[model samples]
Target: MLHLGKPLVVAIDGPSGSGKSSVSREVARRLGLAYLDTGAMYRALTWHCVSHRIALDDAVAVEAASRALDLELSLSPDQEYVRVAGQDVTDDIREPAISSAVSAVATTLGARTQLVRRQQETIVRAGRRIVVEGRDITTVVAPAAEVRLLLTASEEARMARRGIQLGGSQSQEQLAVQVLHRDAKDSTVVEFQRAADGVLTVDSSHMDFEQTVMAVVHAVLDAVGGHRKNG
Candidate 1:
């Protein structure tokens, strides 16, 4: 449904475990657009700080590290990965330790500034035709995107999905900290729990991944019609 001549930029925001990452990636793949995971950028910074033994609570040090962090991220949804300083931390970033500490880095104001600037640069690199998802993408990062969406799910649904991803090994309490607690922490810096004006909201609480993907794709087509108009 995309107009090849005028590439579309889709900005999606959602809480953790709402399926935004998986859904946005699939939508980008279907539309042949680049994908950006802003949350992973924060996670990469967290991984870097942790590797260097930088305390998460040290705001000044974390902000300095954010500016100097060397990160390489893949835009292909099919081959998504993150590398920091030539070291592959793709799998390491998803470990429970990183998940538990990522919000600390994400909540840092100066850190967010650095990452957001890089995100804007990335969007430009994509020719403004990309599917970017994260806490503040629809509002703060790309408020003027061609298509803006906020994906959400009930707490029960979100926890269930994340629990399955964790092989049901994490206790309900552990999952709560990872999902609810993390969202609460990140929400302070970015208002992603609700849809902003001009942003479409998709509740994936009941729908499967394919259904959610279609919902987002429909949002994009609805925004600019099936074709770009002649200037």
Candidate 2:
């Protein structure tokens, strides 16, 4: 599971608001590896579509934009940026306007492929250790990854976390409805992946953020130990 010289590649996947970002960041920090947030890639593309007024339902136009994208994802202790071509559009992608339409753009097969291909390319370049986190990393982008984890939470908890992030001081009554709607759509994705297997799963519905991060970090370290013994 964990190999020392080969680089400890950790893949963390799950639904939205499941603390994937925080967990992945902490795991990468503790392990001293780079962290990749694949969700931000989707959000960056979604931001592009909105900025250009591309029709969310028009796959052709969306694919064209995706194909032409020169996006960059950078994560540091102090800054995270999703760069579109040359512009840093991290903050732009998180606005409420982009959030409403992101699922539509993200769920499209063409859009996902466009982003996933780039993500896999980044893995090839990491060379050493890396922690990649996103909804599809386990099932798609990093299927051969040594350490895979899926973190999930109840719909109620998910919505509450998202609402707090949305405004800092806010309520989930509105976000919860949207979260449920997202779940309904994402169910189809799970069904579509019926043939997938071998992903370690975690239900963080009742877990605090620190607990969630520790769980994932421990999993990665355990895997590294096994990787060492195997060698």
Candidate 3:
């Protein structure tokens, strides 16, 4: 694999259904870097709380759960897994039930603090050469990253993409709850709708998947210099 001589931390932040997860994973694969889906960490935490019947509104309980979260997730673009307390929750965390409750856990201030620390530690463990994507990655988790990007799309486009992503199972109302409402709740804590200073924004409202990916890749190359070679 090709490698940059120095650490190349690519931090990407965006709202729900904004293609942050898929695009960041592909960007990491293309750049030969590790991938960290910080949002999944929140989802996993939500799943844990729901499984244990912990009240999502109970901030103290949620924060305690965050600090004690025994979460193991895949850090590679090629593999996809999330194990919470040795239980494989890769598919469990993506359920609609978890989606509806994730923002509750994510927006808890104390919980966010604990998770952000874990995410930062994960970056250091990866030698700071990873593509991290989430709601607050660019601004909070890795503000000093070499490349900071905000991948976004129009709400309609985002909902459409999310519907397709979920295999057309969710109704329009369900999509609105999952995509728009969740964004609204999460935004109370993280400013992901607007790009922060020095953060590049790529609006994929009218762009296809390949086009959007190339746009992000171009932005990375422009910011960091040179195209990454494929292995």
Candidate 4:
């Protein structure tokens, strides 16, 4: 069972195309902890927008819709998925249209606040033993987390990984440009920047997905210690 006040919160934060989501999920599985893909929240919001024919740039409307979102973020031993108001938005969120626009959807204050509150509520309610993957969880949502790791990869390497994940023959350069631009936006947005201190930054540039997961999991567990210390 997931324990509260569980002492260890593995907050895996990184840029868009970095190995944050996949590796963090794997790490949580091996450790038998809950995993949350916050980026998928944004993607699902993007899907909501697409479904409603809303203007992607309108932050007020987006935030309103976000507050009304009946969203669920779920993790099991075998798979991860997200549903908005009981409908699966998993595949819909990964569409190129949604991928290109989620940053705008996520960058707003309303969106961030909504998600951050949900994030904090979930972690604390779950007793703090979870692996949360996102751009801002370490710096913003889970700053008090016992263990925070920044997973980063070289631009080329990240692009290659994204291309593989997105589809074959897609433009890595274009995706890289978008990812870098999103990074710049996220880090420089004055309020939503990186955590200044106490973040274990791990470079997954040269590591395979499993290798990266193992390294990060080792570091997080090493810091927190098993068998429930502070919880």
Candidate of highest lDDT: 3
Q: Identify the superior model by TM-score, candidate 3 or candidate 4.
A: 3
Writing each residue's lDDT as its tens digit, candidate 2 over 106-188 gives 77888788888988888877863788987778778888888888788887788888877776544465575456666567566
TM-score of each candidate structure, all chains considered together: 0.96, 0.88, 0.96, 0.89
Q: Arrange candidates by lDDT, highest first: which order?
A: 3, 1, 4, 2
State in Å the error of residue 98, model 3. 0.2
201 in model 4: Cα distance from truth in Å? 1.0
How large an RMSD does model 4 have?
A: 3.8
Worst 10 residues of 1 by lDDT: 222-231
Candidate 1 per-residue C-alpha lDDT over 1-231 given as tens digits, one digit per residue, 9 for 90 to 100: 566758578999999899989899999998888999998999999999999999999999999999999999999888978999988988999999999999999999999999999999999998988999998998889988999999999999999999999998899999999999999999888899898888888998999988888888777877878643232
TM-score of 2: 0.88
For candidate 4, give the lDDT.
Answer: 0.77
Off by over 4 Å in 4: 1-5, 190-195, 226-231
- State the lDDT at 120 in candidate 2: 87
Using lDDT as the yardstick, the better of models 1 and 3 is 3
Clashing pairs in 3: none
